[model samples]
Target chain A: MPLVNRVKELRARHHLTQGDLAAKVGVTRQTIISLEKGSYTPSLMLAMQIARVFEEPVEFIFTIEEETE
Target chain B: MKRVIIQSLSSIILYILMAFTIASFASTVTHSLAALKSGVFVLEFNFLPFLLLIIFFVVWTIYSFRTRPNQQMGFGQWSVRMTEFSEVDEREALITAKATKAAYVSFSISVPLFMLTFFFYPLFQTAWPTYPVFALVSTLIIANLVYMTTWIRAYTR
Candidate 1:
């Protein structure tokens, strides 16, 4: 299974640049970029912070896709 | 900015001192090795290199502590922050890890092949010195280069 995220979509909806969101969340822009790209998974604290920034639940931001046999 | 400049200068000085110390030690080691090869037992002890290494470490510690992101941050946290700022971020770290794994896999496969080739070298009338130290160092360098290149490409593309 792979994790998918709506970080890029949410950022666009909020009219926020990756750098803007990253600054608001006290992280580097590259971390946001990685989140959007689904290359790195954020910690629980980071996920909650990001969710707060977007005013959404963590589940709304990230989801896991089950592998098909 | 001023502090950064001072830190940079100090770092440069420490680096130069370390380099000089290493060079001197290398020369001494080479001389000793040559002497040993010529059936001469000449052992000399020099503590300059060790002292320089300690000084270099002290300089690094001072610089790291001075440039730490916050007073509340512990040394480990400060070190992580410094590395994150100077080196890769999350994405690059992930890519680097993958690249390193791939490099290790290739290295494992290649080493035995290389050894087998060396084993067959005498049959081919080829004379080569099987220096394990040199071979190991070169392998490590090549593996690191491969990992770096792969990591960079993965991120850039």
Candidate 2:
């Protein structure tokens, strides 16, 4: 199952650049790009870090993508 | 990613140089042995080129393995030390794992193919005693190339 995330949306809402979030989350900017594009999945620690950055819970930021088929 | 590219290119050059150095050293030893068997006691080997090649190869190896000065790497952190598996971040680590898997797969397939060539060794023994050395070096070269290609593709994608 694909992992759906609202990283881009939340990042925009918070006025955080990709680099900013990556630094805040202790990841490379490329990782943020991948996460935003739904091409990469984060580890639980990374998920928690990102969630902490946005002052939100992990579930609010990420969800298991439902199958449309 | 840039560092990975540089490391890959440097590794390629290092392997090539290593091949040349090994071949040259082998040739020198073989010729010296042949001359000794012939009772030609007057040894006239020009060691300058061979020595220079060895020196250069050693220097290049050191340079290729050295990490960036600003990069704080722990000695016990094998993942961080591994050029193919740069674990500076979790995502990079994941990409490195993928690349390492690709390299391992390539190596697993290539080793048997290379070993198959050993069957022909009897035919080339006298003609090319250094075949095994070259084969080993080529295997490393191929693995490095595979790893680099996979890493670049994954990272870019």
Q: Using DockQ, give the best candidate's number.
A: 2
* lDDT (Cα, tens digit) per residue for candidate 2, span B20-128: 6777677877788888899875444556556766686677545544655334644455234545456678888888899989889999988999999999999999988
**Model 2, residue A26: what's the lDDT?**
85
Give the clashing pairs for model 2: none
lDDT of 2 at A38: 90
Could you tell me which residue pairs clash in candidate 1?
none
> Which lDDT tens digits does candidate 1 get at residues A1-69?
778888899999999999899888877786787678787787788889889999999998878866222
Candidate 2: global Cα-lDDT? 0.81
Off by over 4 Å in 1: A37-43, A65-69, B1-92, B120-134
TM-score of chain B of 2: 0.79
DockQ of each: 0.25, 0.80
**What TM-score, to 2 decimals, does candidate 1 have?**
0.51
User: All candidates' lDDT scores?
Assistant: 0.66, 0.81
Q: Candidate 2 residues A1-67, lDDT tens each?
A: 9999999999999999999999898888999999999999899999999999999999999998883
